[model samples]
Target: MGHARANGDRRVHHRVDLDGRAVVFQRGAHVGQYALENLSAGGAFISGERELRPGHLVHVLIDFAAGNPPMSMTGSIHRVREADNGVSLAIRFPVLSADQEDAIQDAVLRTLLRREEQAARLPLLVFEPRPRVRQEIEAEIRSFGLPVTSVESLDEAVRELEGEEVEYAGLVIHSATHDRASMEVVEFFARTESLQTIILPEPDGELNDMAKRLSTLPHVSVPRIWSRSELRRALRN
Candidate 1:
């Protein structure tokens, strides 16, 4: 089972195929076991023996076999339709905490990477305050045939990193107008072993001192982005 979409679908979150089992419950009574077909951060589709009507509040324990404990959540039945084997129940999660959302995203991303071998390479993250510089960097990164994601602020980048399970290959940070708090966040990402981070400073030496301090950090590169070759070499390294 997969996403049940119609013509001209306008879904916000894309669904991923999931193969697992769940224990269904309704009205504080145990119903039966169901097969988890497809899943997204917001909802999932499960096929069960008994027919469950829409608007029925249900609890499910998703067997995410990624070394973590099973995910238990409460949701309501959004819709129901006929399936090949049994009836399918569309479950909609109305509420999710930050940890819960991260767990689901991690599970989904793991499943996708397992299915596709080439998906291990994560996209490049560009954190630039200047709009023109951000656009230029994104274009240059794309020219290298690499996928990139750009964020205007450090907070936005942090949110994206925490909310999604996608790993980042590298980070290009332009810290011209960023405050101390933002610089601290950049340094945190720079020191991460999983990503290669390059810090670009303005011509006025705005971030020169910070760059010098972070020179001793591992996987961190300081480069002048004005020179195309220097920037390219840093990204490649």
Candidate 2:
């Protein structure tokens, strides 16, 4: 059978302000209507009374305003922030057929093009540089049996991630030396497909804040070592 065709010329490459679209947020047999605002490859930003926290999986249905039939898919809320005097969710959709995937990609590209056009006239924000901490951190990563590539710059790290063939199940990011840089590494792995991430607290640094923040992320697997053995047994069973 051929992949299903999306109805009508509802352009997927453009952001349709979903304020009036018939959007539904659902988990299992439960369902509720949500105010869907924007959509892209990253996810849908929605507002709802339901407690849709980050990392919670749900099904979404959207009907284009121009009489196109509804498109539906499963999605996970990856980020949440308060807006419109209410909660706003960033939902990431996975598991789409080729046609659906293309539609989403086209939409995202269009949105990005618009953003770039606007940003061309605005000043870009830059951050302070990350200090050198490769040698000190490499030793700790090695002890975990993970391979190490000690790069002096984020540019090098990005290149390595794009080309490196290392088979790592998880990446442990240390908050040593450079705080912003360490979190940047964590964000990189989190965005990478199929890669798991564990944020290791800075050995010499305080853990109270890190522990609180890490506890909230779903992609983050805690007690990293403990999960490994448990996962193996679960798979076997």
Candidate 3:
């Protein structure tokens, strides 16, 4: 099981590159106005009007200074809380290959190693979620882009996953009503291939409690996100 360190040794946290311009994805659209705070090879945290519910799925766009056009990646919401300025979200990316992860880490490390590197540019971004999250996360997604569907039940969600001809790079499982189903899904994927699953705690869930619930689960990884660049970096990592 992984443990969240106290304030002193947040080296991993420091790796996050936070500038004002990172993309903000909340609902179906990208909110280009929200400012970024920090980012790492794992995920990102951002400032925005609406609060993202835990366990939601999101796609992030990152255009770091080292690269040309922004690239997009998928991630899952790990935490969302009310802060003094606005709502804050901590996300983790699950759809990444070893080469992709290495590339992202190299990109982030290069950006960090350079003293004069400009802040990474970010895309307006588009956020889409499985139907269950539409009501709570839709407003946030609209700030990014529109979704393919609004699936509200397990049967619908399964159908959506099965209909696709491509192998998914990631999966976001809500820890609400589908807790058992989510676990079963993860096991199913593990038996078939190398799939990374992001387990989101229900809204209002304490991080400590959420961590414990997800601990010991196989084929899962968690990263605290603060920027779109960070989310992209995570995909490469």
Candidate 4:
């Protein structure tokens, strides 16, 4: 919700510019097409002459590019600002299902990849907020002769994922990350047809319930303890 997050400059999701349009419905009535831009898995920004009040609930059918059919979504008007031409409204998506988030993320990735861009060479992205744990993760990655880009927060990791110069091979997240925040980031990664691997370092005899919970997903792995072979298998899969 970059458009509405006024408290800080922190963004855990990546935003991409879109040549799209939104068919917004207010109170189940059609509000017609509004120009759509700055779409992310998290939310979208729509601009039109119509002014939607903040906190108004709306359903949207977004016509994103790349020959894909319109995708239905729901959001609330989180922020509104008057522009020289008209008003721009930002939608805050809430309680999105994992599938929905993955779809939007795929759409964003396609747009990014279609701009004559080359995928960045594979590197392991380690998101561990704890210092000692972060060091161990880095050492593990390097032991496999893999390049590592480690970060201590979701915001930093998202920055790395969105950057054009670094395509990640895998993501190794600590089990200790806040459950909500880690899942939000992980949903963007564990795709159905993903080439990227995601590993959650689930140490034994610890309060890492999230590690076990997330490992149920198709592309997420949770090795109870780290062994070079086990970690290597998770990273390469």
Candidate 5:
């Protein structure tokens, strides 16, 4: 649902991209369900409902993975925004106990660790058409400590992939699998069997059917937001 810290970002903790359903509550009553976008030890952001306000205290149950029990937490809404599709929430948690903080931080760390392990110790290729958007995303990738080669067109990415001098960690793009050209490249990634890829839908977009299917592949990640690129830098162990 979003990207992370640019320059001058004062956030003390780094956020990891997470996919989950948040059952929200207020005043000890069930409120509604929302999509959990990203999370850190300090707080998290959720999108999809318009019935909340800043400073509102909420209790949430996060059903993150299939097998694990939902995590319950209490937080205060620090900010809110009206997005192209719906309202987004910024929830700030108060100071947690050492054990509580450790558990939360450890969980967030594992998410980034898992993603990087899938495409570790190698460079990355980012394909984006818009110059401004590409630059913003480029900086975000670099923040993760991966060497990135950003291209403005698919043709450029094609040439880079065909070359033998560099082995890429993965391919990052913002597109749906329904697009013929995009599908072809992702097919190539699967065919190669050695590459990994990440697909981020357009800012105001939802994932297409084919994209969801392709996400089942081990080398593919279809997360709505970029994983915390600054976990190591921002989190204190």
Candidate 6:
């Protein structure tokens, strides 16, 4: 069993406890393979020899097992602590591409679902005004074998949430209009501490301001969703 200790951690993204292997490289040269103790879309904790120091830039290839493709990304060591056997290095991915972020989210979600079989079928609530965007998000969530409740308007989503007794795994909101109705829906979920809220804003649109404001709330993520992969990553987060 993996142990999780978020006692004093102040990370924006939630970390999922997991165990995996990753190949660490520096300057295009192979450094060593280490054991990944915990992971989130933004960062990870790797245990290995205390060779890398804080602020050391490196590329990592994480193997998620079973036939899943390895996830590769560049990051810097944020912190390092001495462990019983070796050292635990906190690696932060300052810049993660949409695909890379999605891969990390997928791996973390898989581990979480596996650990809690009851949550495997948890429903995801999606509110997007655009038909194309709504369909895209619904398809991606369905691909994970989870149920999705997609609505074109914030009012409909709020009605569904209030009417249903189902526990949602997360909520994705993409509003191009960012009208008062949408802000109310965002505020509703913001007050609900149990749900993870993700806002996907259109580039250079009014939604940007709302995204920024909502991002200040706890368990809320505002990722730039200019492309499909980016939207998928935001939804997963």
Best by TM-score: 5
Tens-digit lDDT track for model 6 on 108-201? 7787768566565678788888898788878877876678888887668777777667777778777565676677667767777456787766
Ten-residue stretch with the least lDDT total in model 2: 119-128
Q: Which stretches in model 2 have alpha-carbon errors above 4 Å?
A: 1-22, 103-237
Sort all candidates by lDDT, best to worst: 1, 6, 4, 5, 2, 3
lDDT of 3: 0.51
lDDT of 5: 0.71
lDDT of all predictions: 0.76, 0.52, 0.51, 0.74, 0.71, 0.75
| Highest-scoring model, lDDT | 1
- What TM-scores do the predictions have? 0.46, 0.36, 0.37, 0.45, 0.48, 0.46
Q: Which regions of candidate 5 fall more than 4 Å away from where they truly are?
A: 1-11, 66-69, 120-237
- Prediction 6 TM-score vs. true: 0.46
Runs off by more than 4 Å, candidate 1: 1-120, 192-194, 203-206
Residue 37 lDDT (model 4): 76
Kindly list the per-residue Cα lDDT of model 4 for residues 139-158, writing each as its tens digit.
98888777888998888987
Q: Between prediction 2 and prediction 3, which has the larger TM-score?
A: 3
Residue 156's lDDT in candidate 2: 54
**Which ten contiguous residues of candidate 1 have the minimum total lDDT?**
1-10
Model 1, range 1-237, lDDT digits (tens) per residue?
142342113234688877688889888899999988888768888897788889999999888654546899999999999987779999998877667777777888887767554432568899888899899889988887778999997788898666667777777877565677876776776666445777776765346566667656878877654556777777766
Choose 1 or 6, whichever is better by lDDT.
1
Q: What is the lDDT for 31 in model 1?
A: 91
| Residue 139 local lDDT, model 1 | 92
